[model samples]
Target: MEIDKVKDPATVKLHSQVEMGSMELKSILGYDDQGLVAAPEKKSSDEAPLKVLYSSGSGSFNRKVMRNTVVHSIRTVVFSSRLNLLMPFGPLAILVQTLTGHHGWVFLLSLLGIIPLAERLGYATEQLACYTGPTVGGLLNATFGNATELIISIYALRNGMIRVVQQSLLGSILSNMLLVLGCAFFAGGLVFSKRPQVFNKPTAAVNSGLLLMAVMGLLLPALLHTTHTELHFGKSALALSRFTSCIMLVAYASYLFFQLKSQRSLYVPVDEGEEIHSDASDDDEEVPEISKWESIIWLTILTAWISILSEYLVNAIEGASVALNIPVAFISVILLPIVGNAAEHAGAVMFAMKDKLDITLGVAIGSSTQISMFGIPFCVMVGWIMGVPMDLNFQLFETATLFITVLVVAFMLQEGTSNYFKGIMLILCYIIVAASFFVHIDPTAIQDKPPETKE
Candidate 1:
């Protein structure tokens, strides 16, 4: 009887089992899928060995697939080289959460998964940059790469986790300036230990100035609220925060204008020695060039998935925090920023590996600048619109940390030279900040009204 005509459940089951068994046998015998079906009917014992394509068309196609398989296999062997191999673990984490209602494990796995996804987002932005010029590319990467932090903060704000939102924002700044930049410098030093890594001094100076401007912007409100004690203090502080946010938005626009137009030359790389290669392509791998539209599509898809994962990650926050007995403020300030800016960490490291201090510096400084100039202000506006009304009056410790970070990084990069010890010193500063937060962060310091829920 023809298998196609078989309608009996027993017969269908038998056939399916037989087919699966045959496929399994072909797999055990070491034959390709195409050979499985074709071998029985057409392949002869004497037939010419399946010629591996070494040319264009079918041969090239087969070779490409073979090469990719071999490369991936090798990458698995070299764990440090192919961190993106962990990309598969992302979906696996989602599955784990779905199968077992364990928010703790889900949070852990999701955190692990987010690291590679964020890195890929940065990679996608780089591929997108090949098609779009520096201006658009920088904008795209900044908005999308930082999307993780922004989305996570928004979710936190909606849940009335105002402390997390504020802490995470400030933490991201420190992570970028201190942690990420520190790692970059360290990596650069490793590669070019004999010589100092030099980048565009002028560009670094401008970024430093802008970061200082943002630091001052944050400082004013903290100072005002601290110095003045009144019955309407909360209202005054809120009003001052909103006004500062508006001014920041304007300042951000001017920064963009400066980067894109008036001071664009400072950013343009002249030679390999002087140029900071914007992650146009992965130096270690043959990353396929993607179209602009496809890049956007993937960017959107990745950003959406990141949002979902972030929710799960954040949902488990309380559980994890309680289980670990860590302060919520510490998690928000240290761990959350690390999770959110995982891409920057990896990107900065990648450039540092290539000894491109300029790009490494750019990624670190650029990210902090964006968060200060754009992200904070945007979140403040969103909070107000949602009736949550987040303010910029960060804890004195947080404000002081920002000041120190900006001061130290600015001084370090002022001469456009970097060394291993410098990187170590910067990292030590971050470590000190993290340790302090772990010991003293008070989640209850900021009193925020709960976000209203719909009936």
Candidate 2:
């Protein structure tokens, strides 16, 4: 005789109820039918909340499954771009440093290696932003977008290469405002030759204002040093630099609050035509290629590799300058910024070509604002902690160049419209800046400065 095979009716009903409850719980926890988290969805106020309870084992199992999925996605994230081909340069740079004494080669390799990683870092950040809301995402972009320059500056500061740190930072701002923005304008003008490319004037105005403010902060310290108006000679310039940096940081934070919170509408694209185009483009919208956790992990890994490569690059700066017969100023001001910001430059130009000048401006002008108001000042504070004497006194020539660049950019942005001519002018101006730096000598270069000690 067979055992009773029929299930109790109450038992079958209870099992079905449990399964339904499990599905509801998964949905509430952001999982879809396959137990994978779906793309972020807007919650409706009218939808009833579902309540479900689960044992600890179920929670642990869910976490394990998620962890494994993220692990497998690593390959997708790493091989996502053709740029990974340059990743080998990272190992090559390290190998050159270990096996050879060619500082120039090491420096060149390191620079090439960091290019792809820098771009990938930005890619990862953008992917991660799919999960974080726009405000936080904007902040993340601001931070990581300049991570390369920041990391290099830190390494240079540690080695008492304060001038390198200052010049490189100045170069970043100049590159973004001039080279990147100019290229975007030029590309957009060519692509939309029949009509002028327009962007959010209010947003551009705000960024220009911040750039001018940064210029003022830098100018005063240089002026105090040059005009000998400091109350305490050498110490006064450093003191003012630190104080002004603190104020600038606060101002930047306030600006962030305004942009991301208070007056976000001012930054939104206003052209109805552009809005239609944007909506149409949504059909080709980019979906996140990797999970949020995967993005985070890749970012950490890329940043760490960049940091490692930066150390080698920083150590080779002077050596490379001598071996390559290039001025240290040129290397710092012209070469480094161009390479470090290659990703940003490409992104801005692409947006401009798409007639999305607002995004182009945000990429170019917004980056300049972040570097000037946030990155430079943050470096000053870090240097202060390490007693590196990293002040805002970027020297007379450098300060004048920065001031002129800001003025020129501010003028270009006044109309909130751009053409190839304006783009050409900006590019010519940057060329002048680069050529000037190539010939210019920093009287207070690392070799001339006295050794730094902790205060």
> Top model by lDDT, which number?
2
10 residues in a row with least lDDT, candidate 1: 446-455
lDDT score at residue 51, model 1, on the 0-100 scale: 41
In order of appearance, the predictions have TM-scores of 0.75, 0.79
The true-versus-predicted C-alpha distance at residue 363 of model 2, in Å, is 2.5
The number of the candidate with the highest TM-score is: 2
Residue 118 of model 1, lDDT score: 81
Candidate 1 colliding pairs: none
lDDT of each: 0.76, 0.80
What would the per-residue lDDT of candidate 1 be over residues 74-134, giving only the tens digit for each residue? 3432243366666666687688778986766877888887877787776666667657644
Off by over 4 Å in 2: 1-77, 128-139, 271-273, 276-280, 446-455
Q: Candidate 2's residue-wise lDDT over 84-140, tens digit each? A: 789899899889989986898999999989888877776776677568743355456
